[model samples]
Target: MLTYYPGKTFLHRLDPTLKVLFAFTISTACFVFANIFVLLGILLFEFLLALSCGLWKWGLRSILGLLKLCALLFVIQILTYGDGDVLLRLYGDWVITFEGAEIGLILTLRITASALPLALMLRVTKPTALANSLYRYLHIPYKYAFAFGMAMRFIPIFAEEMAEIMEAQTARGVELDTRSFFKKIRLLMPLCVPLLLSSVRKIETATISAELRGFGLRKRK
Candidate 1:
């Protein structure tokens, strides 16, 4: 689920620290620019740079996902707190303020603009490279860094397990068609229980292994 593709893009060539700095700088600019037009200009520039790095399709898809999430949030905000001018009053008196709608839109755009480039950076940068860069620049402990690396690696493992479990249940004539949402959810409980148990066991084993290996020991030299 989380793997990097090798490429000769300039982003791939830059030092990891520089790439992170660039992402942080862009994120800061997004927050600092209160005007939507200026924030959009920065987002457009980021899109161009992402395209230059040979990941245009990936970047665009991620940005679109952000847009959808933001749109959903805006809808919820309008429905719940919308008042003044009265864009269809619901249940009586609860109104969506024009100011509130504008605030929501600006906030959504700012968050999306800030997050998309950082995500793109993650997509292009490998986990090992990121961990090493963090260790070198931020003085992060290797144990914690390696744990983060392992956690990212496990995402696909758990996903594959879930898919296999779903397929097995489907083969066994378990109708998960969701005609009854609650029933389908109940069926998922069995799968979830075992998965949770396995995850707990894995965590316990890792902790014990770390203890045996003197993971907390500092170098005497």
Candidate 2:
């Protein structure tokens, strides 16, 4: 779940704006250096920080998908940026260069390091506190802040709904776990229809509720 977990940890006690600043600073600073060692250090720091907040397990689980994505990006970078000292030569001049691999590794680490801090913040900090901090400290409009928080809160809900839908379909004799990648994609495509319809219905209901509460017309000082 992306929603905050109530805790008495130091991270939970931190001001939302300070947490946002720390995440933003680390994420941005990660790109300022191209060194793999520095990126690794940042990644280590993130891991330690997550552990400090008692979120190491959740952080690892959350980042598994991201790790796969980073791996894919690393492969792409290695293939596309192969213009340096040859490390391993493949068939027909397809060479894996040392420089390319180094760059790919650094990029992957940087991306992962950049994402972890913000993910940790979202996991530990309440959405209402985040939104209020954004409105008060960052001067962002309260309506926009509320929408952002709601979107974050809804992500896990939508994911759970989709999983339930898939399970229901599987129970009804639908084969969704085929080994063939394309077949899996084809099977999954139909599931999106129901998810989209449900999302639209939810949006309609939320909009009507907000309107009833005069959410847009309320005056702010």
Cα lDDT, model 1, residue 179: 86
User: TM-score, each model?
Assistant: 0.76, 0.93
Clashing pairs in 2: none
lDDT of 1 by residue, 75-178 (tens): 77777665456545456677777766766777778988999767777767777787778777877887777677667656667777777787788788887655
TM-score (C-alpha) between model 2 and the true structure: 0.93
Residue 111 of model 2: what lDDT? 84
Distance from true position, residue 125, model 2, in Å? 1.1
lDDT of 2 by residue, 1-221 (tens): 57787898999999999999999999998999899888878887888888888888877775675777799899988887769999888767888899999999988888888988888889889888899999999999989998988888778888999999989988898887667867877888989999999988987898799889888886768
lDDT of 1: 0.76
- Give candidate 1's error at residue 218 in angstroms: 6.3
Report lDDT (CA) for all predictions. Answer: 0.76, 0.86
Top candidate by lDDT: 2
Number of backbone-clashing residue pairs for each candidate, in the order shown: 5, 0
Candidate 2: residue 97 Cα off by (Å): 0.5
